[model samples]
Target: MIKDIPEDKRNTFAAIGLLTVCWASAEYALDFIIRCVHERYGGSQIREAPPVSFKGKPPYLREAFANHPDLAGYLPQLNEFLEEAWQIAEQRHWCIHGSIDLRADASTFPISKIIHGKEHRQDTREFTARQIELLAGRASALSVNLIFFGIQTVRLMPKEEANKLLRELLRKYSAALPEDGPF
Candidate 1:
């Protein structure tokens, strides 16, 4: 059955699948951090886990962290990750939702999205398989870094333990973590 499919379609499918897995990993990590922060500091009156979703995820994270003043120190790093993650999210959105147009040479395909919001907006971009692969790699790294960020939070550990684990994570994944990432 796979052999019957066109090469471009097959490649597109594979890329999408890889990106989805990477994105899901990052999303799950973000959710884990949010839930931990909420439960640890939300107090007995707040019994429910904080809401986490693709839409407004950055804001949701900001609000969750803000609710607990102690996490203020991590805010800058979290903001940086959120900015990068949001860019990746946009590319992922276009890949998944935009109309696909294969170039004549088939070296690259253009994805177009039309926004019918307050102001009409048209977005079209060409993507190569290599570009998609790079995006996937970034998403994967973001997931790992997010998990590290979470370990540093949760206050379950003493200050020393939290910093110790963070240092170990950074040292272990030195290449994977972005240079700008908090050490």
Candidate 2:
């Protein structure tokens, strides 16, 4: 029967919502990158389900690049970008994993984690509105950059190079594709 939550609690709730949106958008970007690679090289064999792990994406992209020499020289740069993205992902995880408790006089959410059956309040963090907004903005911007990176990688290749395997892949899966709409 929690009622009469203070204004600070309201902001805390909003911050949680914003962080949720941030993480989801970032995750979507990670998947979109892999999907682009599959479409260009992996053919119909690629899984429709999202990747099993977030950390696995960079390696998968590296492998994708290795398989296609034309996409070379991009892996190092991609790795650098991905490392930055991973740091954000780590922060997102920390926020998501922590429990936000609202106190009557506080200005923001106090985040705490439970360890060894005890709530370790000593390590708790107070997440301010600005911090939340910054995280969300970073996530949103990163997602856009990720999409652009994928597009740029594909476009940088020669037209024939880009679609070299795609044509054959489509032919291979032509039978699987239904005549009406997507199969």
Top candidate when judged by lDDT against the true structure:
1
Question: Relative to the unseen true structure, what is the Cα RMSD of model 2?
Answer: 10.7
Task: List where candidate 1 sits over 4 angstroms from the true fold.
Answer: 43-49, 120-122, 155-183
- Estimate the TM-score of every prediction: 0.75, 0.66
lDDT by residue for model 2 (46-131), tens = 34543558877776777777667767768787887788688777767667887776543656667776544465444667777678
Give the lowest summed-lDDT range of ten residues in model 2. Answer: 174-183
Q: What tens-digit string does per-residue lDDT give for candidate 1 at 1-183?
A: 889867876787688779989999998988777666666766323435466457756876776666668887778898998998999998999998888875445868888999789989988888877788889999999998887777766643455655565667668876343443343
Clashes of each: 0, 0
**Relative to the unseen true structure, what is the C-alpha lDDT of residue 55 in candidate 1, on a scale of 0 to 100?**
71
Which numbered prediction scores highest in TM-score against the true structure? 1
After superposition of all CA atoms, the RMSD between model 1 and the true structure is 5.5
On a 0 to 100 scale, what is the lDDT of residue 30 in model 1?
A: 82
